[model samples]
Target: MIELSRRALVAGAAGATVTGLLATTMTSPAAAQDAATPAGPAASPIPGAYRYKVGEARVTAISDGVRTFPMPQGFVRNASGEAVNDALAAAFLPPDQISIPFTVLLIETGRRRLLVDTGNGPGQGPVGLLAPTLAAIGVAPESIDQVVISHFHGDHINGLLTAEGTPAFPNARVFVPEAEWSFWMDDGEASRAPDRLKGNFQNVRRVFKPLDGKVERYAWNKEIAPGLVSVGTPGHTPGHTSFELGSGADALFIQSDITNIPALFVANPSWQVMLDMDGVKAAEVRRRTYDRLVADRMNVAGYHFPFPGAAHLAREGEGYRYVPVMWNPVP
Candidate 1:
């Protein structure tokens, strides 16, 4: 059994509360400034990045950028677009646009450097900034000894290859979820999939073909790497997974795609996403998992969350709210 220390839980809760208040206060002022100064120099706000210590390990969150698009029909299979838009509006986001931010984490555990997931590769626009971001932190791609993937989604796997379609990390071992690999590699499954989803099936092959036998498949409940244990979290994909990163008395849950956009889905765990292969099961898992998170006061890192992506979940008026941690300028 895994346990969370009382001190960590209290700290996370306090951090979440402060963050929520700060975000609420800052958003209005920022938006007003943006509207009033349209012709001002477009200087970049300090990068969305942060670092925190989880026991002996040092975790850094790097931004790969964000992609915003109209909320696709059936985006939330169980809810109407109007309802989804309402939720987005409440979060001070545009009602019609869905923004997905890509965040990758670097875990330095004294002896080893581990990268959680690679972002969409170069040629996809600013998203390929992971490589440069890593460099900015003084860690080269070659310095990463291991790459642990939660699933085979394009945004997560595309960074495995460089813009030229070659291995991005020359000296890293890739670990993929066994169930995910099996589902994607099954020709029968692909043949049976709906026309709309066949592209994902094709993408899995394209990304892994060059690696050939180099990729290692890991099972749920196993430690794919030091201090990183894979937990079975399916429905988004056959082998979709979440990770439990623990050291001593500290822990963080790496929830990759468990909720596509927290404001919309996390606030309404019963809502289903079109990307969920099994919507009903996904909702069941989401509710149960989040119930536990709320009860345990756990800190989570969401892949599609705003940059840095680390947040503390809290029960809010029959749903939940994601309160992002403050950006610590010094990492």
Candidate 2:
């Protein structure tokens, strides 16, 4: 039995509280001048947090930021670099460069604050903003009730611990797919893994070792909270999962890293990206998932999609197209 920790990092958790000087010095003459200073030369604020509703549940897309790298050969293992470049150009993206963004979901079910995935935790460059974004949205890191991980990938599970290697969400129960845990936690499995995969195996052990007796392993077809249902959409990882949010008569599918940058994979379903652990299985799942999304005309969310990564999938010609949901002022 997992003896989960009940400890919490409690402070200013009753309601969203601004921690900086602005709240206290708003009336000060100095504050007025500071506000007029324009902070610095014109620059756009970092965009991350967003909110919407799935029935009575309040859902948010908290961004962890992005990693932009020069397009490497075999970025799409099955497709040629030239073909990928063409697709990028068609999507109006710069050629020879790829940017992967990370967006985690927050589902507030009136009673429970459930986070779908934790982004790259602190120390990761250009990422690790999940904690701050939660703060901005009035949710203290300690206030999260439970964290349901899609799989054990670094970007998804690294945020589970702090810089010192302790559970970041002290009081929250960490739920992971049982299948993922079994494979990665096995000593024999890691020993036989290829050199390139040794790091991934090591990282998973590093993250969950301390919480061995505490992590809750869940199975597929289970309701994570209330209307949030876990769907087994593996392949990227042996146990990678996606979710379906059903409320009232409405529904939203949470597609977790099933496909990265839809402009590439979603538009060309047959073209496989580099990270599809089981490329064939990944492509199979991708096609099946998108088919349902198109038939249902469902609103969906993707972790690697642009910030607030909520969109609708459509069957274009050979592959499919993603239409982003228009931003709404109210949740």
Q: Residue pairs in steric clash, candidate 1?
A: none
Q: Where in model 2 is the C-alpha error above 4 Å? A: 1-46
Off by over 4 Å in 1: 1-48
The weakest ten consecutive residues by lDDT in model 1 span 5-14
**Tens digits of lDDT, candidate 1, 47-123:** 43456777777787767777778878888888888898899988999988888888888888876988888988776
Candidate topping lDDT: 2
Cα lDDT over the full model 1: 0.75
Residue 68 in model 1: lDDT: 72
* Leading candidate by TM-score: 2
lDDT of 2: 0.77
Model 1, position 113, has a per-residue lDDT of 88
